[model samples]
Target: MSKSVNRVQKALEDLKLDATIQHMPESTRTAEDAATACKCSVGQIVKSMIFEGAETGKLKLLLVSGKHTVDLEQAAEVFGEPLIRADPKRVRSETGFAIGGVAPLGHLSATDTWMDTALLDHDLVWAAAGAPNAVFSLPPQELKDATASRIFQIG
Candidate 1:
């Protein structure tokens, strides 16, 4: 496994999760691509998005469902401040993973994270495993617990 995959696996193990990361023959960089590769509904893919606190400059993770786009206005209201889509450098430095493969766990630092409530509708959801071509499937609630994510309405 690549270092990225290893990092994610170790993190999951450390969390005592039964999820197993699987490597794909092709890049699962986008929600559509991942859905096709995993043979699951688009809504079953978790998009680990990073946003910067407009004033604080701290990173926040948003585990959104692939089927919907985040409502920025609602997010700002919930955060009590504006949110900016983090730049690539900030994403890599803070999360230890590049764009398109940021996992919900194993971040370089502890970040405030929220998960879309819509994910709860699915029994299993797929998340990036610290690499674009690697992913893991786990129960949505289990993932929420493992990542310490607060469930929220994203869109």
Candidate 2:
């Protein structure tokens, strides 16, 4: 396994989660692709997005459902400041994963995390496992707990 994928696997183990990372021949980089590869509804895919607080330059993680997009204005209110897209380089450096495979857990640096309430509607959701083609499935509540994410309507 690649180091990126291994890191995510170790994270799952640390959480005492039995979720298994699956390496698909096809890319699971995009939410649509992941849902297709996992044979699930598009809404069941977790999109791990990173944003920067414009004022503080602090990174924030958002675990949103595939079917919705984050509203920057609302997010700014939730974050207590304006938000900007985090640079890809900074995201990788801080989270230890690239844009297409940023997982909800196992970050190199801790960031404030929030999960979209939409994800809780699903029993199982798939998240990228630190590689474009790697992913794992777990209960939505387990994911919320593992990441210590504050649940909110992110989109």
Candidate 3:
């Protein structure tokens, strides 16, 4: 396994989560692709979006459902600052994963995390496992707990 995928697997084990990481031959980089690969509804795919606080440069992680796009204005309000897309280099440096495979947990640094309430609509959801072709499934609530994410309707 690649170091990126191993980090995610170790994170799952550290969290005591029973989820298993799967490496698909096809890319699971996009929400649509992940849903198709996992054979699930689009809504069941978790999109891990990273945004930077414009002022503080702090990173925020948003776990949004595949079916929805985050409202930046509302997200900024909830985040208490204007947000900007984090540079891919900064994202990888801080989170230890690239854009297409940023996982909800096991970041190189702690990040403020929030989850879309829409994700809770599904009993289980698939999230990227630190590689473009790697993913794992777990209960949405377990995900919320594992990431210590604040629940919100940001998406």
Looking at model 2, residue 87 earns an lDDT score of 100
Tens digits of lDDT, candidate 2, 19-137: 99999999988889999999999999999999999999999999999999988877667778888999999999999989989999989889899899999999999999999999999
RMSD (Cα, Å) of model 2: 1.0
Alpha-carbon deviation at 20 in model 2, angstroms: 0.2
lDDT of each: 0.90, 0.92, 0.92
Write the residue-wise lDDT of candidate 3 on 32-114 in tens digits. Answer: 99999999999999999999988898999999999988777775677788888999999999999999999998898899999
Candidate 1, which ten residues in sequence have the lowest lDDT sum?
Answer: 71-80
Backbone clashes under 3 angstroms, per model: 0, 0, 0
Candidate 2: give the clashing pairs: none
Model 3 TM: 0.96
- Using alpha carbons, what is the TM-score of model 2? 0.96
What's the lDDT for candidate 2? 0.92
RMSD of each: 1.1, 1.0, 1.0
Off by over 4 Å in 2: none
